[model samples]
Target: MRRRGPTRLGRAAALALAAVIVVTGCTAEPPPPEPQPGRLVGAPAPLDVTEVYLQQRIAAMTLREKLAALVMVHVPGTDAARIRSVLDRYGFGGVIIMGDNVGGPARTVAGLTGALSSEAGLPVLTAIDQEGGIVRRLREDDAAAARELRGLPASAAEQAFRTRAALVAEAGVLINFGIVADVTPDSSSFIRSRTLGESPSAAAERVAAAVRGELGTVLSTLKHFPGHGASPDDSHISIPRSSIGMRAWRATHAVPFRAGIEAGAPLVMMGHLQFDRISPLPASLSPTWVTILRQQLGFDGVIVTDDLLMLQRSGLPEYENPLRNAIRALAAGNDIVLFVLPADPGSVGVDLTGLLDALERAVGDGRLVEARIDASLHRVLSLRRAASGLVEPYVDCGPKCWGESPRSLALADVPPTG
Candidate 1:
């Protein structure tokens, strides 16, 4: 070869350049750095009860047991034999007790509940209208009972319900169809003294407080949902209607219900009243109102009817027999039917077996869908599961509250009930 400039490359420079290129080409990229510990690192994930569990439970039930689970019947007597007979014949989801059930003592009621529970190992949803004031069956003179709750600070109201829930638990009542959420300011209103009182906002605050208090102790229910102030008539005697339009209804009547739901009330009792402007149908049988409660207000708990038997008293052509009414109630989203026998003498006494028969026929004939029944059946069972008496500390309410000679709390016992 001809002589080139400097004859060849600089040895040190060529060696350094070759070394750099070879070192870069041979090296491997380090793996992504290991993630650092997060704030929630060792905490266990929250339990997620899949819907499959609930569906499995529902699938295991028979048609009779399923339908029976959806009806909450009124048992007239405290006679353990009579009560046991009724229970033995029908597996009612619940039994409602009144003053008649409370003979001399709270133990009488406890005994009734114990007998029912013994007959069926499952916890019976023993309910009462112990709203205090004129609505208390256990303590007829409850003017002071709720006075201790009304207008008090939230903490105080919660504490009061805690004490009251203890009393209710001792009486073997898991559900208190108490905690009136209606804003009927009319002194003549049937729900007058039973209310939390003063104004809607104040009453709403108290209603929520009562719910918080009763949560772990007893299942709190918001009564007469969407307010019972629409019609002046007593729901027990005739069907009532709310005249207020949607805007005003939302503004005034729905205040307490909204608050109660926010406070986590386990159940909302739909009244027999109709809000014509909202839905032509009675609120208890109206899907519109229920959609408002479920979709808008976000109420995911149980929705119970005031009393299906009241349909006969409604005088509305659309509402027929209690059985049909019960089906409508479920279709409209009511999870439980309160089948209180009307005090009206001419009306027929409630027959739960007949009601079950009617429902089975309805389901078989396609008048009521099995899925619709399942919807309600599952809801009722779920509520019983969540708001169970398992946590309650059962004790003797003693003669003071439920004794034959229970100390009177009222100026005079007026057979407390609105």
Candidate 2:
């Protein structure tokens, strides 16, 4: 005979017993352990993730795309869609936001940068020259510049840059092409006013402090590397030539760059100045200088060119070809070739596809080793990944993770932006 189902009262009694058991078991389970201080919770280590992601991305990219990813360009305007179109069509790795690009307020600039960063996984590296003196893009950054900070204490440099970096990050910019590392003692020098310090040691101290100040907020770049004080001429119109020997350079110009690099600056902008004693070519296109930077100084971060267009503007026949300059800059070991372009790139003879094609051909004919392209791509992509917030969020270490509350440093006494 088949057993009858439980009676209504019997079923009710059984359900009640099960509910009590469930409640008791639930209460018995312990909550997860608190995330250890200085460690990320429920996430894989960021460095490992970054390495895996970068390799995967590099392997999947076409030769053209890889070449494009090594380029950073600018489209002049506040029109977000127009600027974004250039970045998207070329698959550029970054964009340099100029003064003209910053149309309205910080929030409005944020909207522009937000549009430029369409790729969520690995956003483009949006940079600006918010150096706070003659080179600031944002109007609100009235913090101490090189002229004032050069005389102040090191703490002052740190305080000033901390505020500057905050303002840059607030505008949604990822990288700052600020922190002029060039040191000069010549009162007549063009870079004198822009130099952080009059001497090498003083510049080194302030450069390190500046890097520290920008540590967590944004990626700090030490610009016009190999030192801009080598010559009195501007790089925009002509290549500055210097007669300083290697010993002199290592003693003087290299000090601040080394300090900045050691202090955790992620990118160093190679200047267009020529140290004739070191190498006849500009530092931006000199393998000797690159090797010196990498091996001697132990700089493993991305090395970017000052501006490829500057070479053309020098009125030199050899440097007039934009495509050729980019190739040389890349071959010389620059990880990223920077171009500050106008709205119409064609007017300046900057053909996007032509540049890519030239790079691919160079690799094909062995002018540029495929391995070199791969190496630079690794560096460039690694920076993009880090800037995209993949590494920082997962890792709890490094200067970028410094969670200290900023000290009360007022900027009221600082002069208005020049």
Best by lDDT: 2
In the range 1-418, model 1's lDDT, one tens digit per residue, is 1111110234356567668768789666545533322212222221123233456567778888888888787767668677756655777788888787787556656877777754232466788887766677887333344555565666776666777777788787888888888877687877666677567887888888889878887889998988876556788767777667988988787898999999989889998888887898888988898899999889988888887777786676677677778877777878888886534424655566778898788778877788877887777766665544231112322222121121221322323211
Which residue runs of candidate 1 sit more than 4 Å off their true CA positions?
Answer: 1-53, 118-121, 140-156, 315-320, 342-346, 386-418
Clashing pairs in 1: 104-403, 104-404, 105-402, 105-403, 106-402, 133-142, 134-417, 230-242
User: Tens digit of lDDT per residue, candidate 2, span 63-175?
Assistant: 88888899999889999998899889989999999989999777889989998877787889899998898888999889999989989999999999999999999999999
TM-score of each prediction: 0.76, 0.82
Q: What is the C-alpha RMSD of each candidate to the true structure, in Å?
A: 20.9, 16.0
| Model 2 CA deviation exceeding 4 Å by range | 1-47, 344-349, 391-418
TM-score of predicted model 1?
0.76
Report the backbone clash tally of model 1: 8
